[model samples]
Target: MSVEIVTARWIVTGAQDETTPVIHDDAALASRDGIVLAVGPAAEIKAAYPEATVTDYPHHLIMPGLVNSHHHIGLTPLQLGAPDYALELWFAARLSMRKLDPYLDTLYSAFEMISSGITTVQHIQGWATGDLDEVLGAARGVLGAYEAVGMRASYCYAVREQNRFVYEADEDFCARLPAEAGRVMAAHLARQKMSFADFMTLYDELKAGNRNPRARIQLAPANLHWMTDDGLLAIKEKSDAEGVPMHMHLLETAYQKEYARRRTGTTAVKHLEKLGLLGPQLTLGHGVWMTEEDIEICAGTGTCICHNCSSNFRLRSGVLPLMELQRRGMVVGMGIDEAGINDDRDMLQEMRMALTVHRGPGMDHSAVPTPTQVLRMASEHGALTTAFGAEIGRLDPGRRFDAVVLDYSSATWPYQDPDIAPLDALIHRAKTKDVHAVLVDGEVIYRDGQFTRINRESILAQIAEALAKPRDTSEQETHWLRAQVFGEVERFYDGYVPADTPRIPFQQGSSRV
Candidate 1:
């Protein structure tokens, strides 16, 4: 059966021509088999598909659904305002406080994301017990929640192996280690001891369960700074072998770049390039600390970068050189980082932040990204990060009908000129509250400020209960250890160049208290 949606005052299809008007005053979009079949004047569409069921969105502006490239769905409730600290200390506190619960994590984050007009998210799944049963179980729970809430996601089991602190060491460590060794020893840990063989098995299992065509699955290497050289190379090889994209955090902070350089005798981008890991299949998050050479390398190798605006400002990580990256022909996507910083996965808010912040001192405001370009970053550029650019970013004929409708009556009224461009108003002036309807793969998943698929209240209640539980912080044993983390971070930034370097100044209108 064909479904026809009409009554959109304006439809921004995200096509090539910025002003190529496709649907005018009364437009309609028809879809069947989850693909857009037609989009044009309502009268013409209705005449073409007489028997198609019609749904009307009277005073709404319709556009492509948002694509969030990098996000941590499990970190939603941790949105506590943690400012005035560098990246390591802030990360330590977050890792210590935020306990992972599959059900609550997905429920709260998915609901917030969909409500905020983000139809697709690339979720970096958090730490899990190194047991296949536990890991796959957690993955299933998250996938189920996303499916239930009608949100498309590229869910990755974040893989890592690291040394634990002395306090976390077992008593048997005394016999296993030499006298010079501390109470703890570096242990070979895998979230799930998934060899390449085991990972393939688990991938197939998860893929089988993903019935929704819109929900994509991929493997993400957590970060180069976190993983060892062997682990990084293995991840790159595995992703290439399996034909999946590899996502990782890169050059997020100046300290991270310095740390990578000190440890590996090369910058993070150069190190990855040396390892043969910088390629089209890679998507690096938070390219704020990238050098010009690094940007050129990424462009040459076809590697993508996710520019996370909110997290950068909140954590005091420097602003990404977005215009330069675009100029070099790199695919730049937008992300909200983890939940607590941005607070919500609102793509419109992210778009606004990206545009405003990138226009720093001595830069032309007009040279910054327009609302349309920002919209493209959240939609098309984001899709490109996950290698789905050609399939899911726009609402054109033969494409998937993933779209969001904004109520223009209240939010966009009093336009002196009818030709004032609804797209501008939607990007700059609109809020999540204005989102009236959302569709994924031709299915109406959200409407009338409520979800069509999941129980929002139930999910919220579960999250509340999870947050109330007692957290375990026994791992952070000594004040010296805590201080060491912060001190290392501080020292790392000692030689930082705030003036000579390309930097985005803090916004004058920031909500700093």
Candidate 2:
């Protein structure tokens, strides 16, 4: 590609710390060969890169593309008939969802993310079932979709050895179910059952086959409640040997915290620490129930956490105490764990929600989350959680020129002030519709309501055609019954906690007390 200079009315140099995002006015960004060359005064850039093509936006705000730190299959659980239930029960309801073509399903979400200023995503590929060949093919289809769209992605094959559905052993949980239900559950487990060695071999083969620079594979042991000790050890060994980062769901529910004590005689963080699994290479999906000590361990080990505010609220998983997490100086990132509030995967709305939801009780104005903090989490901090590692989040001189251009006129229309901070207004008020263009590696992949590389409308049409077929009626019946089984399992888990004791996330030590 030829050299080009993108000049905007204002440019947001994303937050490098807790402070406000730095903004440059009347500036231009120069790029060539898919990398940024400079970001400085437009006049200077014009004088230096006079031969470079210039794209001018007089009423636009340019910033680094959002990095979605954690995501599962693109389809929101609610969209597929799974209502708002606890995480475990919701998983059961999700089993009934008809599977779509992996490529289309992946693109379905990719379009939403790209349209909303997200350039990179950490896709936690958890639906690895069927035969080995089928699983490999599915993985390829998903990754291929990202490659097709020119978006960066970190793909992690979720591995779990035991406790596929509920916290108990598979056989024990099945014993409590009806005969027909037991058979269905057993068959499901049988399909999911694969030896750790075989899984590692498969991962090796898949990673070797998939050499896309934009997409990388990593490891994820589902969670402490699901994986056995051996499985955890395997993940650690592989992560260490291969030098690939690992991301996993951890203590997102109160029940999980209780289960940790019963199973390991300590907190989940402590157990992971004992196993030598806490480090910079590990990123926890949701640390909603993390205690003070857990936070300390995370800070000490340089571990990262991705806060999925929308999912936690939808599932009644309790607030993540994000203010506390950031105050502790731990690496934090933002994620629309299950799309967003509207199930449209709007990063702008996600940013607003993340900023508003974590306000603690006191009247201290500074205690509330700042727009800059949320922006950093969505951009720079988020890059840390993915395989990209600081390469795609910021719009630095040497970084990849991945950015989102928002029409400032539409974002702050009807009321625009010169003194008002543009970054603050953009984060608080911008919508996906305000996004004028999205660039990846110096190329405009999405511009003016269209994807430059693919026929998005045709892809949606194909998806509609695939879903027109009626699903299996028997599978629907099992979905309804499994809800009851999962409910019973949840009740059984309550036995681990004592009625006299109040299960709190952490103890607050007051100055007077």
Candidate 3:
């Protein structure tokens, strides 16, 4: 709209290093038409923007809005009836999840996401079984929900050329199964049948029709095991030609590491490097299994990473080398993945998880995570991974006016040391309930536990009613089929990794002497 001033007790500049960070106490920022105009002391900002409408919070901390850089589905797998399994088997187990309308499902998570101070997301959608048009419609449903909710999103329908289930090719894997089970499994995969040409075409079509100014489109190569050599090359060529970034899932699990070794005769990151696909325009979703050298390659090429901490733990995937990745100068971002530790999209918790999980049993403060580093991952670095680039990350002149106001008094509650570091307190003590308001593009979309653009209660009520029905016959049959074939998928990985193994992630040499 017009010039507006948002003042708070403290302002987190979203800029910091190991021990030093710039937090403005008794500060404010001025914005106009969705762009930040200036930021300085509260009195100076008020005087500078005299005619601007003022929204002042005397007991809140204003910080840049968070970015969930590697999100997938709207509803988490747990909510959709899938139990926690390792990353590989979890894919097969997810086949039985009852289908919900994509629009409502997206809104279900958007509510949680926004309430948790997430204003932007990197939504990498995939695994829809349908024709091109049908799949495009599903993409529309998801993008529409974000638009309706006023959440900025970088949307991509991940391009998966092969290995939809196990590490083997779909056809070859199904061919070895029992005749009856093979047929059912083949039939299940047949629904998702799409050609490589269709993947490129789908990206072009979506890009042309995307009407949301706040939203951007990108190409995702899905995962290393999922893409064939030619398909990976094609995706890289397209990304280079079109100047689009690619958010890919690679080396997420130990099984995936083994799969890469088999397929590429090297590590997954090395495989991408060989293919000439590692660069600034690519953001790897979960580099959990990436070796020390893999981290070096990524850092060398300016490759970004989205650390899905909760997802890795939830799926029993190995922990990411967050400390090493950050130390080697990689632009690592934070993501909740399917859900956070508490099974929701709270970024504060995700940041906390990142902060605490990386602390080794050592007294070296330099090796441990700093509050500013984690905050950067959740805000600035996370935004960098998405198509949003430098447009929506920081709270400063020239950046988009997207930020969260946290009730400092409520967050610190009955007692907090006045001399305590502001960033430390914000990261360690803040909760989703402490979010007083969220602004996107200079507009207050959510404030005082209410969404300004949409009705949260109505959406939640609708979702509850919509999912109240019992499973239909088709859903029941899918569940039975998954049960029948679960053992088959498990058997494929029986000896995937030997009883004795070495060279695990974040470590350089053999595990044993």
| Model 2: colliding residue pairs | none
Candidate 2 residue runs with Cα over 4 Å from true position = 473-487, 494-497, 503-513
Query: Candidate 1 lDDT, tens digit per residue, 1-513?
Result: 656655577777784632233335678888887788878888888898888888888788888889888887654434532333566557534433455567667777777778778888888775555567677888888887787887788877766543222111233323344442323222222222455445556667887677876677777766665567887887777788778887898888876776676678778998999999988788999988877888888999999899998888877887888878866767788888774245777777888888777775555654466777788788877887774556887888888888888888767666625676777767777888888888888787988788898778877777777666654443333222333344433443466534464544333335358
- Between candidates 1 and 3, which one is better according to lDDT? 3
Q: What is the C-alpha lDDT of each candidate?
A: 0.71, 0.85, 0.87
Candidate 2: residue 435 Cα off by (Å): 0.7
Estimate, for each residue in 227-340, the C-alpha lDDT of model 3 and write its tens digit: 888899999999999888999988888888888877778898998999999998999998888887888899999999999999989999978878888788889888898988
What TM-score fits each model?
Answer: 0.85, 0.95, 0.97
The alpha-carbon lDDT assigned to residue 412 of candidate 1 equals 65
List the candidates ranked by TM-score, beginning with the highest. Answer: 3, 2, 1
The C-alpha RMSD of each candidate to the native structure, in angstroms, is 5.2, 2.5, 2.0
Query: Which model is ahead, 1 or 2, in terms of TM-score?
Result: 2
Query: Which candidate, 1 or 2, would have the higher lDDT against the true structure?
Result: 2
Candidate 2 lDDT, tens digit per residue, 1-513?
A: 778999999888678567667778999999998798988889999899889999998899999999999987766777766777777767776767776778998999999999999999999886567877777788889999999999988888888778887888888888788887787777777777777776787679878988788888888888998888878987899999998999989999987888898899999999999999999899999899888889889999999999998888888787787877788777798888876888778888999999887765677766778888999899988998988887877888888888999998998889978677898888888988999999988889999889998989999999888877777664566566666576666666655556765656442323454
